[model samples]
Target: MANFEEYKNIWVYTEQRGGRLMPVALELLGEGYRLSRERGEGAKVCAVLVGSEIGYLAEELYAYGADMVYQMDHPLLKNYTTDGYTKVMTDAIKAYKPEIVLFGATHIGRDLAPRIAARLDTGLTADCTRLDINTGNYMKYLTDYTTASSSGLEANDGNKGLKQTRPAFGGNLMATIVTPNTRPQMATVRPGVMEKRERETGASGQLVKVKVELCQSDIQVEVLDVVKEAKELVSLTDADIICSGGRGLGNAEGFELIRRFADKVGGVVGASRAAVDSGWIDQSHQVGQTGTTVKPKIYFACGISGAIQHLAGMQTSDIIVAINKDPEAPMMQLADYAICGDLKKVIPELIQQWDEEEQQ
Candidate 1:
């Protein structure tokens, strides 16, 4: 068994691409900072920065709440290779043990985190929506968020275990997992779920440079060139306003109206899982538990019933406007502004009013 006592501080795999830090990395730092503060044992929030010539990004990580940064700079790591990154990260984890490690559930993070965990013989919880270090906070989360009865659960106030909560059974249930035996408890968090702290303009932190030992023989696949796809992809996470459609639209053609309304409001088009599964829209436009989780400033739900699974994804939006004929629908009940009218008629009227207001 590993000596859990030796591991200290929290580490975030600060993922970056093309010299730009990913938003998820900043968000994780925010969470790590909070966890470290709650743990209250001089546990610092640290960031692990890997890639060639990326040491310059360390300052930004510090401003975002990282107390320290582990810089791993290497030419072999300039472009991400599974073998190169995994080897360096595994080596670093073994050398400088951390109590907790976090990764964003992006494509690279999903691929990298599991490999490092396997190498270190540690446990990793993937796609976690929530994390807690304090026992009280964990218990409160279970009581408030999950449907499972917390009555039967035992509480241990002294347990400082990382409570990693993730959606299971197709977003129908939430499971909180812990790795008490592991030294560095690891988890991959989905983007847009956690809140990011405001950046401090000139904050500073300690920087540790990691030594990299890698050769060509370690990597089997060679990336010859990266081809950029020339197509417009919907960026739901970055959108301030989102106009979404659901099964109540009745047919795929209903999305046409949704698109028009979205265009009018300068918002992006979003769709519920039902609409996407029914071939009403592309999977890229899906916003829900089985899809992308979003927290837009304004979320307009048109013809949606608002199932729990759907609510899990967009309930965090700043303001919700539900347009459904059924007044008793869950969306209408949850929405800040519920309109009990046919969306077909309501949408046009809303547009006309918006246009008239603009004309003035």
Candidate 2:
């Protein structure tokens, strides 16, 4: 095994598009700071930026707790392509060694991280919900053990690796993974799972500019133009409050009550997989293992059964209110506030109360 001491610093892939930083990048940088802080001054939190004319984002990274920013700026690299990004990022990692690299579990990140990992011959944990540094928990298990039968491995520093924890087995359970033998521990974290750190006033990080050797031949794909998506699209991850309905809603028309309640509460409508499959609502509003993950300030589970898959998506909400007639349902049990009653009657009653309160 190579000397782990040679690998230094924690790096976050600061993903951007059209010169705008993604929210997940800042979220990961905040987590990187937390992981590096306990390791003392030697382990620095660095942001690996790859885009054209995005050098100005260095200060933003610094403000969010990045100690250093590595900017690989080029006109050809403005738009993200799997071939172009993976090549430059893999090259950068080889030049500047990082013990752990964090990437957001976004569309681009999902495509890029795996390729980079394969090129470098490293393991990657994808869509991780949590990340932390090891702190002597595994040392006790290895204390009585000696040499490995296969690789003849011995414990040097058991508490010094990055702890990558993620949902596994169709989101039924969570598994924690550690790459003790790998040079750079890599993981793709889900967006909205980690909280963003507050920016510091007048704080700045060290900027390191990197130049990549590239040509038109190197990029297999070319960007002719960029088409922007609708600005008013419903994003559960970005919403403050989400009112979700499941099979408990009874039928497609059940969603009408949910929509009314959601509108009254100033929240967006979300759907369970059952609701979506039954054609009650669009898949865009589905929340589960196969659906979008969300961590809203408040979540209302209207007729939503708390399946492990569904819980995995929205359990992180700060406040969960479950409305179901069955008190024994998992959703009701996990909720901060559980209303054991018929939603048909309860929903209208609540709306009526809201109307009265508004009149007062």
Q: lDDT per residue, candidate 2, 20-81, as tens digits?
A: 99999999999999888855548999999998889888888999989999999888898998
Model 2 TM-score?
0.88
Q: What is the lDDT of residue 97 in candidate 2?
A: 88
Please give the distance, in angstroms, between residue 144's alpha carbon in candidate 1 and its true position after superposition: 4.8
TM-score of 1: 0.90
Give lDDT: candidate 2, residue 174.
Answer: 71
* Residue range 1-360, candidate 1, lDDT tens digits: 898889999999999987789999999999999999988889999999999999999999999999999999998898888899999999999899999999999989999999999988899999999998888777777778666666754566678889899877666467889998877899999998777899898999999999899888888779898776764578899999999999999999999999999999989999998998899899888888878899999999999898778887888899999999999999999999999999999998987798899999
List the global CA lDDT of all models: 0.90, 0.85
Count of clashes, each model: 0, 0
lDDT of 2 at 299: 96
TM-score of each: 0.90, 0.88
